[model samples]
Target chain A: MSGRGPSNYMHIGHLVIFEFVKWLQDELDAEVYIPLSDDEKYVFGKVKSLKQAYVYAIDNALDLIALGFKKGKTFFFVSTRLSEIYELSVTLSRYLTFNTVRATFGLEGEGVNSGVVFYAAVQAAHILLPTAKKGLLVLVPIAMDQDPYMRLTRDIALKAGFRKPAAIYSKYISGLTREPMSASKPETSVFLIDNEEEVRKKIWSAFTGGRPTIEEQRKLGGNPDICVVYEWLKVFVFKDLKNMNEHAYKCRSGELLCGECKRMLADALIKRLAKHKARKRQALRVIDHFFLHEVEIPSEIIKILE
Target chain B: MSGRGPSNYMHIGHLVIFEFVKWLQDELDAEVYIPLSDDEKYVFGKVKSLKQAYVYAIDNALDLIALGFKKGKTFFFVSTRLSEIYELSVTLSRYLTFNTVRATFGLEGEGVNSGVVFYAAVQAAHILLPTAKKGLLVLVPIAMDQDPYMRLTRDIALKAGFRKPAAIYSKYISGLTREPMSASKPETSVFLIDNEEEVRKKIWSAFTGGRPTIEEQRKLGGNPDICVVYEWLKVFVFKDLKNMNEHAYKCRSGELLCGECKRMLADALIKRLAKHKARKRQALRVIDHFFLHEVEIPSEIIKILE
Candidate 1:
């Protein structure tokens, strides 16, 4: 399972994460549970308003659906869109304490809002929801920085009588610049929503591992280890990268230049994003099918909505 | 608007509050919104579990319904019984800060849970909900200790662009033992659901402001000023208190003894409770009509509960 805040459009960092999720889904035919935490983003100030976050969730969901996951097996739940997740989050919040959430999220002495503190439980509820509903143990794909949330969820799940979900922790996908490719810096990451020209511009202006001049680069060779475009190519574009280490070797031998590599990645990314953009348009019409609403709200609770 | 964390059965204190609510409704033809904070009770450890809190909310609601609140104007919403409140709470929580909540609640270093902190927002949402839906500012009746909640809600409502609610504050209703009548000391409270025998037992053994000996009392007169029975009689039982100073005068003149007062109060209470219990039984069947379901949940959210 993999999901995001959905307050911002899906970027290159998010694209790689979903690619990994799709890869796992293909290999195991496992059910995918994607929770768009619009509440978290809105409350945490990632988005200006909940309505915007919710709108972005649908927009980002279209992008995810475009990735070609099996529709029948994939379930998407937006935080504010679904009431059960809030209900489940409240249930999970009981077993978690303020100090635990604060200390776990390294929020001690910080002046974060109540929603920020409660967001940990919402995230935990997302992880354990499959276990609660389907009795299926979830295998979440997250980055190493999110270990605390995983650990916190595992601990709370044990106390709450839900199965602890297994997780695959990977490193942060470095940005095109020195900083991480995150919502904080829009220029560092290429968004799926970006047009071909925008994608090409972001890729062309991206940071790379190269010498000052072509003569020095030919003498000392270019360093592919630190090249953002090469890294993106290895992680997402070229699926068979184990054998494609030759690309890196060619760079080291000065057979490949930074401009030449940027063009190659930009072409491949433009092609992929073009196809994704087309599918995203088609996916928009069927967005309703992806949000499963099989929530077992108590009959008494049903009266609240009457 | 009046509500309590429904983790316990309604007692004498609660009865008085609701009586005040009924008085306002009768006088002004006001619409009453009673939200049983089951989530608050469970999260704050007032109840053993959310399920138990919810059950108690429904049961307490029956006692409230029996009090003869107008079915059409009276609205009953249990915290766990509703989804919109949670959504509304999240919306209100955005403008509130943890420091403000902690300082307002004086929960600085305490080990309160995340839900406990977020409950302030939940309560604010409850107060602002009427305004949010019908643009009717709420007039909440609360004791002095709950002023903080009202103040917090008013501040948040202003920030959230909702009209601030007005409040009428009263002092703590003294308990039978000089302590406040609350859930903590069951012996001090006469529950609406208490049987005739229990009512008689509790009222008879209650504290009173009488002299040590009957002879001393006869010579000096009893002090009705500090008497619990007199307080209950003056506050709830006898509505015409301006003329009922004669009863206190009788106690002061030693004409009315503690036994006579207890017997009068107990008999009156037992009769009132008996009527309430009878209506409570009838209330069970018609409770559904009181819970209005005209919640304007967005179509997007409707898919979440599908």
Candidate 2:
């Protein structure tokens, strides 16, 4: 299962992991659960409000649905929209504590984020919810930095009367500048919504394996190891070893120029995203097939809302 | 409005506040909202499990419904059963901080109760939920010790864009032993469900202001000021100045014997509870008139429970 924080727009950085999830779905015939942490983004103070996060979450869901996940197999929801998540979170929170959260997340002594403190349990609940529903093995594909939440969920799973959810860690995807990709920073990442020209411009300006001058690049060859374009090329352009190896060899032997490589990466991204944008527009019509619209909350209790 | 934590049976200590709430309901033509904190009881570690707390909460609701709160004007719900409370809580939690909660609740450095930490926000949500529904004046009939929750709600009221709920503090209702009444200890509290024999036995052994010897008590008179029986008489038996003052006068002047006064208190309690138990039995049939049944949780989302 996989989820994303909807504090920012879905960008290429997000697509790298989503592509992995899609591949898992295809190979294993896996059922996918994507729970957007709209509640967390607001509680963690990442967004101005839960509404704003939810708005972004809906858009992100469209982007994910556009990625060609199986209709019956994929279940998409945001945290607040799915009542079971909150119920499960409160149930799991019985085994969680403020001290454990503080210590695990480095929140000790700087005590002003109770929502965040409780949110750790919410994160744990996200991992174990599938197990809570049925007797099944739940596996999460997560980045290394988020392993703590998975570890905490695993530690308390049996105690909370569920199977311990397993996790496979993924490496972080760096930005074009070799730093972590930030959704809020537009220049550091390629957005899924960015047009072909925007994609080309961003790719052309992207960091690459190149020397100070053409003569030096030809003499010393280029350094693919430090090239951001080469890194993304491995992720986006070439999935096969033969094509990937050929591109790397050309860059290292000074047979391929940085401009030509950038153009290749840009063309690949434009073609992929153009198809994605078309599917995203189509995803809007069939959103109900994925979203959770009903829950356990009693309706008669509403007096003023009417 | 007033609510009792359903970690234990509905006892006399709880009745003191509920009776006051009933008075407010009668005098002000007010809308009553009683939200049993089933979530807090488990999160606060007061109950063994959320299920246990919910079981107790449902029974407590029956006891409360037996008290004859105006059917249409009164609304009763437990935390988890009402999806709207959790939604509002997440919205309000944005304004609450860990530092503020820790310092405000003396939870600083004691990291292990993230549920309790967030449960504070649930408490605020309960207080503000009525206000969130409409432009209404909310007055909570709370015991003195629980004022911190009220204060916290008020502090964040406008920041969350709701009217600040008002509060009228009730003095602590001490147990038969002159300590705070605890539902966990059956002897200290007279549960609404307790039979006549149990009520009589408890009151007979209850603490009193009588002298050690009969001759000394007659010579100096009993001190009604410290008498648990007399304290309860003011709440349960006497609703007027003449009877209350006359009872106190008799005790102070040695006209009312300790045994006789205990019998009076016990009889009053037995009579009151007998009627309450009968209504509670009847309340079972019309429970839907009070309990919140349907909510926002979509049925399609419940994959495993089916």
Candidate 3:
């Protein structure tokens, strides 16, 4: 997977979804090639220096490694460092016309940069690189809004003599006001850096459709099905089915209040993301060594080219 | 300057123009950087493999070296192997909009390719490489038809924070039909590999505006200025002002017949290009090493980023 490193310092959304990457490695027995696309970071992320992007990639990769991924079992690489990857991208970009790329991305005027255009081809190449021999079932987990890029990747892959990747779409978790939660909108989502108190405060202020008065809520009952907090609890917390169903039924029958429900959800989320913070800290400590020695292109490959 | 190598053997046009490059080193006391743009060559030149292009670039560079260019004074590089050059090109491409490039190159839909678009940026970057800080006075002794590219480079330099390059345009030495000489069109130009007998035969058949009969020619003189053979002598041979003017006046006054003029020009060209044949043979000897080492980016630069 190639993209800018998560900007919100890795939240519940990152933890909940990326846990599947670990599951794929251990249970499904797949050799995961995680291309930490510092290329994307330089183009889209706030960073300007390619070196800074390289270091950030190392930090991000170490976080992934700490999630029980064996070092050799998973391959990590930066996009700019790989010549074959860039060449492949240039070739693919040649095949795709400007009109096609413009239409796909809704680009007009001067909005589209060469980096963005080449980036699409790079993304397409990434999906095909792993399955160069074909017939490999490649699964991409992405937000629903990013479906357009996946569709474009599938199209380019079909034309570039490669296998198409299947995608698993996931919805974005919204804030209390039902507004889409984004890293750009700091107040909307709880970041990994947030303390227990901050997480609790954010959850308490979250918008819910529950009644203001206890008497009114008892008569009408709360609709937990459409509640953002309830959805978060189901998606991020309550791994056991029995516990999840009990909470759902209690909320629908007005047996539980909104305040109590938020408290329970926030506590579970805080516990779930607590380990990543320690792991991130540890990853930062050994980052220099990883950046210098571990992330280097294989010497054998360099010798062969030489 | 990275490009796929030439598919066909080098022609007189290639040899004659490159000779001026040697002159730049011999007379001007300048540092030379030759980039074998294999990436551009792959897209434009009809070569089978990128490796083949690399081999061709090495061969060509060695030929230039054999022409008496000092090793350390003149550097050789390939486009695909130099990521820093490509990175700079990519950055410069951003500053240049698609419309500006398209308009500058007079590119229509048929001529527009990703390679062509990126190549302009690469060429622009080549003229501005930081190593060229000694004031880039690029003496491009190309055909007048290629003046647009030099004009574009000059314009780009005005906007870009880099030194502008100067160009020296040479008129095309065309074939019997007044068509621009090209290796692709075998009848249009002589190849370095062409035999002496074949060279004589081509010169005999070459076009000239002379009277059909010698008696008529004495009455109505030939237009030596329009004759391809005479132009070749003036451009390639007869460099002295007195000799060139004497030849031109004699032909115009019908003192020298068209057949005699063709014979003299052919003999001079054959003698002049003889040195290149030996250099070409030597160039092939070290071609492998040239391809292997010429274009690779320095490890020190990569280390700096790390």
- Give the per-residue lDDT of model 1 (tens digit) for B1-306: 988778777786787778889999999999999988877877877777766776677778777888889988999887655667777788898878778888998885747778878888889988888898798979998877889999999999989899889999867777877788878777888887678899899988888999888998888999988898888888657869674798889889988788998998899988887777778778776788788542222333223213
lDDT of 3 by residue, A115-175 (tens): 5555666677666666763356678766676677788888877876677788887666666
Candidate achieving the largest DockQ: 2
TM-score of 3: 0.77
DockQ rank order: 2, 1, 3
Candidate 2 residues lying further than 4 Å off, grouped into runs, are A158-161, A211-223, A252-255, A294-306, B158-161, B210-223, B251-255, B289-306
* Candidate 3: fraction of native contacts reproduced: 0.15
TM-score of chain B of each: 0.91, 0.92, 0.80
Error of 1 at B256 (Å): 4.2
TM-score of the B chain in model 3?
Answer: 0.80
Worst 10 residues of 3 chain A by lDDT: A297-306
> Candidate 2's residue-wise lDDT over B1-306, tens digit each?
676787877787787788779888999899999998888888778888777877777778777878788888898888877767777788888778777887787874765577887888888888887788766768999988898888888988978878888899988766898877877678887987677889999999889999888888788899988999888888888879899889888888888789999998998899888787778777766767776554222232122112
- Report lDDT (CA) for all predictions: 0.80, 0.80, 0.64
- The estimated TM-scores of all candidates read 0.86, 0.88, 0.77
